[model samples]
Target: MKHWIHNKLAKVPAGIVIAALATAWALGAVLNEHGMARQDRHEVVRMTEKMKTVCVGRFLLDLPKEAQITFSTPRIDGFTVVIFPETLDEFQTRLAEREALIKAKPDRLGGDRNLEVAKEVRGDGGMTGKLLVHSRAVKEGTASNGLEIERYRHEGVAVEALMHGNGVSVNLASDFYFPDMVGNVLKLAVKLVPNPENKVPAEPGFCMDGAYLRDPLTADQLEQITMFARLPSNPDIRFLLILAAGLQPDKDGLIERDAATKSQFSPTERMRFSRLRAAPRTIGGIYGEEVVKRVHELNDSIVYSFWWEVAGTTDNIFVPHIVFQMDTGEGDHGPVPSSLSEGAAMGMWDRISSSIRVRPTQPPERVAAESPPTPLGSYAWAGERCPESGWWQCSDGGNGIGVLGGQRQYIRKGERMPQALLLPPQTLWEKLRGVQPSFESKTQTSWKLVDKRSRKRVPSPLPLAQATPVAAAGITSAGTGPSVMEQQGVAVGSFAATGLPCPASGWWLCDDPRALDGTRWFARGSLLPPATFALPPGGFSRSANSAKSIERRGAWRLVRLADAPEQAASDDNGKLA
Candidate 1:
């Protein structure tokens, strides 16, 4: 039967066949064009000057505030980006009822020869659904035994789920892909939350539904919305705004240049196309290319179109391809001149497109996470318990005059104050003499508290001093071979200068007779910081009482050894060091 039909067709002339095919194609194209919805020439376009903030997906943008907005759902995979003009509570309640209705239906796997239920998934945000995989058994080349060999073709899988977040809900579905595209799309939906109160995790992720969610697809995803103007006067005039973001078309579809590519059109088609403007433009910090065109249809109708698109790639969640498009034509038809003037459409496009921007996403800190305050300027002395938890500044400048890290340390409350390294007198002299001095010594020092309100506690620096102290060996004078007292063989009444390392562990008496702390325990090798005096109940202003008013520099005389009987006697007077 096939040979007989082919023999009959081979007798027909090639020119006649070509003409018939061309006629059919031309007839179809003409019918399709005529059947399309046309713009009503009488209807005029109008717009309000007021604008409002519209939150769609994870982004926020300004729209005509007074423009009536109606929500519609388009079949989009991976994400459902939409703006519900209703209150969050209202939307949630309605969404819950819809979910309940779906749940009431009995589950039954349909008996189909070519389709099978691969798996079912249930999760939060109404993510309860099943995946369907397409399969078909086909007979292949026969085997040597004269038996037919059968093979199965796995034609991918598909899934759909309801995702709830950001005050609205949408049904998320995915197109069929070999490696369980349904599961991947569901994973993205499961991570979606309505206004998430958590930090955005590192990438292979994106912000959606007012929260950051992991996007399993390595490919860039795009979503778009077509906003139609409601003009009662010109009901048929189609003036709509199209806003889209994320992935965009490459060279084809809406992204292709219409007027510039007239070379691809016939002479008659080229006569009806005109390019008004095409250039690089920047809106809301996003660099994108723009194009404006006028289309003159064969039916004597005119249409205006505008397009702006940003360049982007995968893994760039922060910088997605933002598209702002406007058209004055019928929805189904290619383009038609609308009652709205081209000038007004351009003005509206500029006003709305310039306002496109990524919404600010700042994670808020919980009030309970804040730490207790540590008053600055609170002072603690060496060998005494720290009064507060915070960074403390030591009065003793460690040997090198003003070293960076050594002068400050973070200390917690109730911890014993460790001594600071003393700045040797000889070291100071060397510095005064324009010479660099180096030394390491620990001496009892006064510490002033400092803190940041945002940080509850400051971390301690690298090993400065031991938590437990061992018996100290004798101290040598700074830059000097030996102290005069050490040479004279006197263990008691040894002199130690302020800001200098202590030569011995003993009860050191302040040389100043009127000082509040007459004598204090000194650990050998600890720096002898200036003696401190208790200030009034209310701390004096810095202008009224300088740092000298609270602390004074004076020589310290080792009155008694720390392990001696006299040293124990000093502790009996409630002065434990």
Candidate 2:
């Protein structure tokens, strides 16, 4: 077989071999391009999917009250719910229903049907206590195949219950086809007793003064009071308990009196006396023996201390001044609170507490100084000035001097001024020279002549003769060679002989001359120069090169060859390189 392959390879032409290599290279290039294109398409799809998920989450969160009240927000944060039955019979019934539903559509739900019935129990049955019940349906592999398949299509439902001293606090969080199931249950409860006060039994627990204390107390207070109550009893115990409860000594000094009484007795005897003092006491004095200390302690525990320097006061009440603070993890800190509620005191407290957190001290004020003025004429460039000849001029179409009136005027390049005040030949010559002459002079000459036919006195042809010669020379010079001025026709002796005078405004003539019927004339007033020279050299060439260099330098390039490889991998894996 090897000998046969060698024979066939030898018979292949060199051109054919080269063509085959080229074709393989082309195929590889096409495949690479296709792979890159495919990767980009996948990236777009993935980003679209992520955006859809985010949009769904936002839509759920931003729903109006009516919508949110009906359907709970999507569970971006992990949360589970368990339903507890009040009695064993109720538990058995609910269990049986769950089992039947699972059996009816095993593919639509999940649970362990054969598990012990008592093991699924939650709460203390009829006893008042909190308990957590696990949903056999939501367990791994327990959901019906059909329900599990729809996990991505919809959220599911779960239930939970906590038995408080007064009643039960039921939580129904669902992850099912409809999120409104839990909401519906809550709505039913709300309809039964729309008002919480009405729904919650007023006398569920003993409402004794101290009993109410335990009911509204915070976790810290509850722990502290429970520990204090469990302490060894003594005659001074009542005083201590009262103090712990925030009650101050009465005007009769009953608390101190009780303390003194306990000091003289033995520990056992003091314990007995303390129990006797536990009963409420009254004193016949200016101030009655009240539980002022107990109220103070309660207030101290509930009211967070803060420095509230405010602008005003009313009704002898300190309107709380609030300051808010947020942690962004970037070390940036500032006060966020701006306003306080008015009308309802309770509303004001809620707003202030929720919006502001007390800080140890105020932040220092930021002081910024004014920036210095920019340097004068910093943007000025070269070739921006007018030339000599007392004519106003500007590269841009802006104000320039009026040659005749000595006033500032505006003119554009390539536009001719009126012939009423035509520029003199000498003045035109000087302007073309681009510099003031060493010797400046003005001359005017007149001559008399006889008409060929009438033989009458008339202006001589001398002015015309001299002007004609100069005009011819100018035309020749303009066409053939370099010269200070180019002329196209005879210069009249009127003002051409005497150079045009410079106005007070200092206008300068442009180098270019206007031509009319072969008569070349200089502009009498200053001109607005061309914004850009038609033919520029030197510096312009350098500017073009600089621009090209900047473009070349600005082009993006991969810093490392390995970066390309990494990028390719990342693209394939849908990750940032």
Candidate 3:
């Protein structure tokens, strides 16, 4: 090739060859420029072809019809349902890419099912399932059957699925008759404005088991709209259930972990149960554990905390809770007593609790097929979802910068409440009556006893008793205050022992106004030690001191004459220590 070029150059005249070569070089450059321009034009044309204005919703479309838009303002954290115009195309493109990359894929849905489901989501706003009303049906199995879902020509499939990350989720597609399900999903991510009454650090993680209403509110306007201040007269009812996990069992068969449960013993809070009860529960055909604690809130409204640990959920957990909020009548703040009647409420709890179940196992392995709507992953890569993930300046239609404004919402949702509270209805009347059930007799009684001096059924003020000595186990390491479990048995005659059956207040503490003896005498808050209080206290002292007073024992200062303070045995007759 070099020799041929030299020969050709040699044959031409020096000026002519130089002129010809320059002309040839110029022509080549022109052709190259035209080729590049054609390629760029083709690229632009192809990009435009892939994108077209898509109908997202009524009064809403992609690329803005004359500069219009639709979306939530001041978007909430952890709860976003925006369908960007670009999502469908991106989803199709990315799904193909993922299908190639995903090696350990689970069974996939049918191609027809995928196409049908995608069409439904685009044509309809969102879809639920047929199990909406059948609260008894198990979800895990119902969810796994994709292609098996019967599809109707006039309507969407009874069951539809979307690809969410690595998992292929089968959703029971419906008309969303049970829209209140949003409350369950939303609360998991909703922000609880700081409250002076309750001090929850953040929103708790929870799940919802929603049942579709046979007859739901049909206001099309309200379908897409939501009220920020309060729930509807009857939002689609659901169980805003929170599940708490138990720690490994210790020697006493107790899982001693931080409960972080809401404080039920507040000054204004009323106690309905004398002590924690570990009763057996058989809910939803799943037998497991149960614990019930009832209390009345500051406004005399009653609510209780129910904790259940269904059996066989996992080996690591003794009982995985299915916590629930059961309100009786209208609470102090809300207008509705409950979405259901008292009978209905009980029925719902039992039915749903009975329905609470573990995720069903998958069918045997079989050759899989492809299915739709981002056919296999979480939210779309960018666009509408970018803001939620702090990914700005991303996708073709996004930076999400204009949408997020300068204030990015930080997520604190999904953090378990540490505890949940519920109230039963009858509590209001009881609160109005201003009476509590005694632990001893388990009967309704007055908050105050028959005053010894006043001869009235009012709390008698008791004088602050002098500090008594506490046993080693009773005194906590710091001794700052009483601990929940510190206990020591005191042995004294019934005469000097404190009353056995506890009062409605549930505590024998000196600070409790209900427990005080009209300031004449009261239980000790802090004590030194038993030997110290005894003076080697004058025990079985000079006779005639038969007046036996109830003396509380231990750091908790249990208000019972169960056992009397340490005292020297009476010589022949009773003596006071």
Candidate 4:
């Protein structure tokens, strides 16, 4: 019967048979590519594997071993870069030290003591989702160089990635990277297809792509939020987002102010899309606000990730948060659907968030003895409230005028956190001097920084002042060492001629006689009388203080910095005033 059938079928058209075979091959390819069941099966297999776990004092997470791990230090003003121990024993030892340090003084420097203790505290509500961040330009880049990979794993699967951290502040940025796998992760890219009418600027990464996160998500806010790179050539593939988790002050509502800030969206997208509601969610029993807002237009293929840390016991503590954002498009134009559905994406998020458990991670056995803390940078206050002010201090600008990490920023007056810019606090040390943070310079100048280690940094002649001892040391205006006032083109001659007005940490501020407002930095108690008139700060030979007081011009007030007196004075007669 088979032979007869074959003989009869041999008369059939060869073209028809060939077309049938080709059609079957094509159909099989499409099914394998888009088949969702096969993908779900892969997910089950991934879940079956052991999950790698890491602890943050209060919260614990069990992520896939195959996923990369990066843990950073927490920050108050900006993102902190933490250093992870390379060896297992080192990891355990370092974590133990971190826990002890917070418990030791909580407010070791002048940072928010409450925030320091937040991580150890547990959340009252249930768990939420998985994510990561790249929120602001905190300049954590300082610690990014030559970073060591922090590894973790439960089963055979393991992932390795760099971790940036600082020891000063509690805030940090943790970045997680996962290798491209068919079952679990997807890669996404953002691109600019030059418009036929206008040309896209050739600027590298300067586009207003991610800066919109810095502002409030007000009513119908359209911000130019793009992914890291320009859209890839093939738009069919899914776009994946990297996760960044960190801490920020819970400003009650969405970091909102009275007025609406400006928008930052691209012209092609035109407008942004958003949907916000009180989705009071629970994560690891921590009750926090679930603020879900889209900072992009619906027409644009993108996914937004945002989370907040559960409220803690004190106002000083900042909450932890997760921010994940990605854009996917079906074609060069139109709203591109994410490869992961809303529900699937949420589950992926929950897979991470729900895994948070309040437990301690086992550190390496017989952890190494803790190393003494190293002082790296020099920081001065600029604004009114120091970091110790807790929620009250406005970080809108930096702390009153501060200097560290190779950049000069405004820091709070009286605010001193030498370790705050830990993207490797050493970055600042390297900035002032060479690699030796504790090294001292013998140069006699007004621009020098003397750390507690007796190490001093004196750069070449510049506008900045040299390091001065906190003691009420006299500034010999007649001598060679120029005073800080002189360098600024102004002079603060002591009327008493007994001692200089500003101490090492003391700053001379322009004051108003009527309101008594000026750039003065006085400690709690000082013998120096408040001079109604202060000579303007500059190298000018003689200039009168801008004051209405009858006291004759050039008669300036001298106030001792009671707190500063404790700081060791440099061997070189460094001058602040």
Highest TM-score, which number? 1
TM-score, model 1 to reference:
0.39
Any runs in candidate 3 off by more than 4 Å, and if so which? Answer: 1-86, 90-238, 242-268, 272-278, 284-287, 292-295, 302-305, 310-344, 359-577
Question: Residue 235 CA error for candidate 3 (Å)?
Answer: 4.8
For candidate 4, the 10 contiguous residues with the lowest summed lDDT are 182-191
lDDT of 3 at 546: 36
Superposed on all Cα atoms, model 4 deviates from the true structure by an RMSD in Å of 26.5
TM-score attained by model 2 = 0.15
Model 2 Cα lDDT, one tens digit per residue, 191-216:
11111121122321101111111122
What's the lDDT for residue 486 in model 1?
A: 52
- Top-down TM-score ranking: 1, 4, 3, 2
Q: Candidate 2 local accuracy as lDDT?
A: 0.24
| Model 1 local distance difference test score | 0.52
For candidate 1, the 10 contiguous residues with the lowest summed lDDT are 568-577
Could you tell me how far off, in angstroms, the CA of residue 190 lies in candidate 1 after the best superposition? 3.8
Writing each residue's lDDT as its tens digit, candidate 3 over 201-265 gives 12221111110111112222112211111123334232233332332323221112213233434
Q: Rate the local accuracy (lDDT) of all candidates.
A: 0.52, 0.24, 0.28, 0.32
TM of each candidate vs. truth: 0.39, 0.15, 0.22, 0.25
Q: lDDT per residue, candidate 4, 96-137, as tens digits? A: 564455345423244443121111111111111111111111
